[model samples]
Target: MKTQRGDIPRRLDTPDPAIRFYLFHGADEASSRSHATRLLKAFGAAKDAMEGGAIKSDPAKLADEANALSMFGGAKAIWIEPAADEIVAGVEALLEAPGAEHPTIAIAGALRKTSKLLKATEASPHALAHISYAPEGREYENIIEQLCREHGLAPAPGVVSRIAGMTANNRELARQEVEKYALYLGSGESDPVPLEDDVVDRLGAGTGDVAFFGLGDRAMVGDIAAVQEGVDAMSANGSEAITILRAMQRRIVMLAPMQARVAAGEPASAVISSMGRALFWKDKPVVTEMLMRWSAPRLARLGERITDLERRMMFTQLPAKSAIGEELLAVARIAQSARRR
Candidate 1:
């Protein structure tokens, strides 16, 4: 059955001998990696299994390896690392088959809410859990609270909101920011450490600046010349195309929720404050205007286009600069579209 990320801790404790296949799918690699590690530990090394690549291309080998007799027995756990579409199809077949020996765990880099794999996993008789790194609704705030609690501290008033705003649904990054603050405060402090604006600034600098801020500043202001120049500079600096697309995708994804929050009569300060202290005062106007200009549907479409471009880059032997230029054109179009709308 389908389960939420929060429910994962409880499910891991269950004593069921039935093979459990967990599909940890999310945009955040850190969260996915962490979940995979937890699964490996719980099932024990004996019965634990891990695989990678396209499933269909080598189904026989995958099946053989996954179904291999457990070294120590007890409960078996099979983990399939991030794979191509073909491999995902093979996994779907395995999930459909009757009487599999061991519980299979298939991890996806990202899965859509309505994906067939997600649906099958949810419908399967076997145990299925989905851990999404996408922070939706109250999840962002919840994560901040959880992080504070874990560090044995309470976030000062508005601190949680501030951190959430800066991170913008990037759970792994948010966690890192909180951990940084926690460390800065040192262990076993007498009282809860209140985050100051400077703390956020330091964290942002350490994390290579707000990537979106750099991209959006050029893109939103209709500075095509500057955008091209900046892109060239970034390429010259040896930044990967995938990294650029991923950052753009993240910012676009964040804008919708942010826009919605703003429309709901939330104060600009409150809405912006929800973002961690990492955001600079200079970024506010550009980001805010871009949010207004780009509708949610448009941003979602742009994100999908970027995903396709990234996939092509990964699977094919295309020249990185050309492929990246194509992706940048798409970003430019989004900016133009935002202006027209």
Candidate 2:
């Protein structure tokens, strides 16, 4: 059976007994692995329950391992990550095996639309296939809210959006930020306090992937030196140029509404504080400064430009890294000009 991303959570938590295999593939490898882990937990399977292997190494061994009884006779599961075409025969063997009780999950990287392995898994009566993608807009916000709930947190009005803003392009970073926030909040025995804007500023600061490289913070503040440092770190760390651009795009999206509010004559501080309901407290001063430097009209233009840049990055064969670097430098120049004005 085929499952959509939205339905995967519910299905995993209440896994269908009929589904014996799952094929997870997408550009978002982190989400695929994380979802597979959730499914295993839901099925009362431990980490030890999974037999891990590579598709290129021993596709046939996958079935043998899954079929082989554990010393403790625990529930069986198989995890194959970064899979390739070599594993199709092994997967087929597992599918054809009689009385197979194990649940096998394959987490593959970017697959073609007509992937044979994916098609076969989805077509099977006892299997499921789900494609994970980077969440966008409200989808990521919902994920942030869900993460809060899991940690027994009741987020204050903009907390979810704030967290989502920080981690939109990266799932692994989102998980870590949410976990860190939950830990700060302590256990659920007592009535948990609603997450506050200042709390996010203090606790969630510098926790995101880009934040770790100091890119987002510097970009928002118009610090040329910091921006250069961030870009250098990104290249050194092998972060994709498109990924960095997407993060900047998300940052621009977050700024548009706040800029609109500021344009409407609300004090920059107040507008930023309200719209920044989830903004890190320490970062508030910087965001406020940026808001003051640019008018709503200018910010709106930048927003449009960012969208255009992201589209180009996604669609065109324009040297992505170079394009991203030029665009970022343009942004810094705008900030510098705004400062002069």
Stretch of 10 with least lDDT, candidate 2: 47-56
Best by TM-score: 2
lDDT of 1: 0.61
Q: Judging by lDDT against the true structure, name the best candidate.
A: 2
Deviation from native of the Cα of residue 98 in model 1, angstroms: 12
Instruction: Give the per-residue lDDT of model 1 (tens digit) for 1-341.
Output: 77766677766656245544567776665566656666667666443545555456676555565566777656566767664344656566666556566667666766666676677667876647565555543666786788777775566555665566556455666777788887886734456666666565676423343353355345644567766775665544333455455556556665778867766767555666677544456556766667656666666776687778767765466676666765565566567666532
Model 2's C-alpha root-mean-square deviation from the true structure amounts to: 3.7
How many backbone overlaps does candidate 2 show? 2
Residue 190's lDDT in candidate 2 = 51
Q: Note each model's CA RMSD in angstroms.
A: 7.3, 3.7
**Per-residue C-alpha lDDT of model 2 across residues 218-262, encoded as one tens digit per residue:** 665677887676566565333456566566666667677887877
